[model samples]
Target: MKTYYIKNALRVLLGLFMTVAGIGHLTFQREEFLAQVPRWLPTDPAFMDFVVLSSGIVEITLGLLMIILVKHQAKVGLALAVFYILIFPGNISQYVNEIDAFGLDTDRKRLIRLFFQPVLILWALWSTGGWKYFLSKVKK
Candidate 1:
């Protein structure tokens, strides 16, 4: 019972984090987000802005769903994990290109930041029971 409460608390925290990040993408941190966009992507500023805007919308939606969809938490968790995976390339690009943003100015800092992505993935899965749900299916 205690564990359940802990997980719920963590999930709520993650939801809040996502919500803030989404707002940042849409507002004050827009340029910072653009810095993370893979350089290989088209350099047109308008297109890049579009990508940021659309992704921010998705992030806000997912964050709200994660908080409000208790009965569907596992599904939302899975989708959030997938979303993390999809956005991972931007992290990779940031590290590889040494694009500084959000205080990840040094190579060591950028490398360290890379490790947090997996933690976020695991957090999304574990906090919402997605890991247990997957294991149960695998055993069948």
Candidate 2:
């Protein structure tokens, strides 16, 4: 019971973090986020802005749904995990291209941050019982 509550609290915290991150993508930190957009993508300013804006919207929606869709959390968590996977290339690009953003100004720091992506994936799954949900589906 206590563990469940802890997970719930962590889930909510993650939701809040996502919400704020989305807002940053669209607003004050827009330029910073632009740095993380893969350089291999079109460098056209408008297109890059569009990518950031659209992702921000998705993040906001997912964050809200994560908080409100408690009964469907496993599904939501799975979706969030997939979203993280989809965006992982941006992190990889940052590392490979040696771009600096969000205070990760060094190769070592950026490389270390890359490893945290898996942790986020695991967090999304574990906090919402998504691991069990995935396993149950897979075994069928």
Candidate 3:
């Protein structure tokens, strides 16, 4: 029961963070954020715009759903962890393609930050119970 409380608290905090970030993308014209989109992506600019908008909505919605669906919270959390991992390439690409987008002037700092992506991924995984599933899967 104590462990469950800790997990719930962590999930709630993560969900709130995601919700705020999603809303931030929608309410603010973050050219820096969108500019990181790889040029090779084939979608038209308008379509990409909608995609960003929709991604934000989806993140926000999933955050809320994870909070309300206590019985399935772990499943939802695992899904969210996967989502974070999936999006990491973009974060890496952004840092690699242009450090300026992140308002950083030094490649050294940027590279250092890149190393922390896995930490964030792990945190998401821990929050979502992915680590538990991962261990079980590994033991099988």
Candidate 4:
């Protein structure tokens, strides 16, 4: 079905996006990711680096699972959604602290960026039929 193809395409695209972002976390854009880390977290630079590195690894793994685990799409979707939720505070801190990264030099831009996380969560759930699956389970 056309809808199924579209959902698959979106999932693949999201996976690619997350994979590239994870690589950035580990490599060229490390400092930018560091900026996104919440100030409330420990200020030890080494600890921040470790956090970034570990989160990057998680992102890469989740991205790959989203793409390759078709039969477990709903489960993958739920996991990705939870991952998005887990990282949301970083986005919130970025906006609240007025720390600019990834060329989001303006507060308005950063605030707008904050909204994308929820969209990603919803996208994961919808694309993989996770929401429908959850609803079905609830009805049982």
Which one is best on TM-score? 2
Q: What is the lDDT of residue 134 in candidate 3?
A: 68
Across 7-40, the per-residue lDDT of candidate 1 in tens digits comes to 9999888888898899999999999999888888
The predicted structure with the larger lDDT, 2 or 4, is 2
Candidates ranked, most accurate by lDDT first: 2, 1, 4, 3
Candidate 2 lowest-lDDT run of ten: 57-66
Top lDDT model: 2
Q: What range of 10 consecutive residues in model 4 has the weakest lDDT sum?
A: 128-137
Evaluate all candidate structures by whole-model CA lDDT and list the values in order.
0.91, 0.92, 0.70, 0.90
- Choose 1 or 2, whichever is better by lDDT: 2
RMSD, one per candidate, in order? 1.3, 0.8, 2.7, 1.2
Model 4 local distance difference test score: 0.90
Residue-level lDDT for 1 in candidate 1: 96
Each prediction's total of clashing residue pairs, residues at least 3 apart in sequence or on different chains, is 0, 0, 0, 0
RMSD of model 4 against the true structure? 1.2
Q: C-alpha displacement of 6 in model 3, angstroms? A: 3.0
Better of 1 and 4 by lDDT: 1
Instruction: Give one digit per residue, the lDDT tens place, for model 3 in 41-124.
Output: 655878667666776887788678667877776677777877777666666666676646656556776677677767766666
